[model samples]
Target: MARVLTAKGAATRRRILEGAAELLRRNGTAGVSLELICQTTGSSKSQLFHYFPDGRAELFCAIARFEADRVISDQQPHIEDLSTAESWRAWRAAVIARYVEIGRYCPVNALVVELSRTGPEAEGIVLDMQSRWHTLMTQAVGRLQAAGGGCRHVEPEAAASVVLAAVQGGASIYQATGDFVHLERALDGVLSYVGVA
Candidate 1:
């Protein structure tokens, strides 16, 4: 059975994860050691082990989940309400602004790239994140269609998938080239297809 943690214990664990995520974002995962995490978080080795008995692998998986949550949480309010053309535009702007601010330091993508080679857990984390994002976007598209903002014939799920793909592709190119043109164009094209442009 899993160990139950007190409120204080849970807070400590969250601190460690947040600290580790900051380190990963700033320096990448190449030189991130348990000692580095301890030093960064001002946490003892025992405390780290108390929360993550399986060590770095387990800790990294937790970090992956944290980053994944951030990916969705960052696009709040706007993503939450996509029933109007204005909301869709706001969401598009929010998405672009977010990537522009984060630049090449995508915590979730970085963690996935580092841990995915080791096993399937990392992949699962990414898949779950993607699935949730797709679902939300699908619902948003459906709302837009119901509101007469989008084409009636365009299926919500399929349109959402394409939009998600476009975002991913745009982010990839943005990271590689330090340019937001691809992301901007992709979003514009996809929104136009759905008649939101």
Candidate 2:
């Protein structure tokens, strides 16, 4: 069973996670050290160990969850509401802006890389995040379909999965090349494939 933290303890833990996330973003995952996280968070080594008993592995898992939440939350309002064309456009713009804003600083990728040290644990974390992400897209497509925006013949679930995959692929390319064309093309391809072209 997980240990229950007091209110102050929870806050401190959250602060640690946030600090670790920022460090991972500024420096690569391999570049982030426990001493660095503790220094930034103003927490002692004992405190860090108190929260993450498994040392760096526990801290890395927390960071992965943090980045995954960031990915979804950063696309908020648009990701949650897809009942209108405006929402769809808003979501598209939000996605584009997020990638552009991040440039080469992709926290998710960094977390993934660090998590690989733990093998399946890291992979499972990524898979769960992607599943949740795809589910959100599926709901958005369903909303569009209900609003008479999507095509009559396309499968919302399949289309959403494809769109999510395309976005991930595009994001990887964008992170490497600092080019938005691939991302735009991927989004356009998804729409075209769904008969929205």
Candidate 3:
């Protein structure tokens, strides 16, 4: 059976997890041993094991989930209420601004790329994040169409895929080359077609 934690234990685990995330952000995946995490977080092996009994795999999965959630949350109210054309534009800007600010230091993308090579748990985290993001964009397209903002001729689902692809492709290029032009143009082109940009 799994161990149930009291509030203090939960807090301790949370601290360790967050500290590890910061360390990963600063150092990437290199030299990130459990011992390093313990030293950085002031956590003992017993405490780390008590929280993450499955060891490094368990902790990495947890970190992936956290990073995946950040991808969605970073888009914020814009993504949530993409009902209006303005909201869609805001969402587009948010997406670009986020990547621009983060530049090549996107740990979520890094974590996804790195951990995905390991196993299903990590792959599933990326899949879930993509699925939810696509669903939201698709739903927003439909709502915008109903509001007479989105192009009536374009299928909401297809349009969502286009924009999602644009964002994803553009982001990958930007993250690789540290250039903003691709992301900006891709988002603008797709968003303009969708009557948002």
Write down the TM-score of every candidate: 0.85, 0.81, 0.84
Candidate 2 positional error at 61, Å: 1.2
Model 3 Cα lDDT, one tens digit per residue, 3-119: 788999989999988888767765666647899999999999999998888888888788778777887888897876877777887888898778767666665565556656546
| Candidate 3 minimal-lDDT segment of 10 residues | 109-118
Clashing residue pairs in candidate 1, if any? none
**Candidate 2: C-alpha RMSD after superposition:** 2.6
Residue 174 miss distance in model 3 (angstroms)? 2.4
Best-fitting candidate, scored by TM-score: 1
Q: lDDT winner among the candidates?
A: 1
Q: How many backbone clashes does candidate 2 have?
A: 0
In the range 129-193, model 2's lDDT, one tens digit per residue, is: 87888899888888888888857677878988897777777877877788889988998787666
RMSD of each: 2.3, 2.6, 2.5
Report lDDT per candidate: 0.82, 0.79, 0.79
| Clashing pairs counted in every model | 0, 0, 0
Task: Give candidate 2 misplaced runs (Cα > 4 Å).
Answer: 1-8, 26-28, 111-117, 195-197
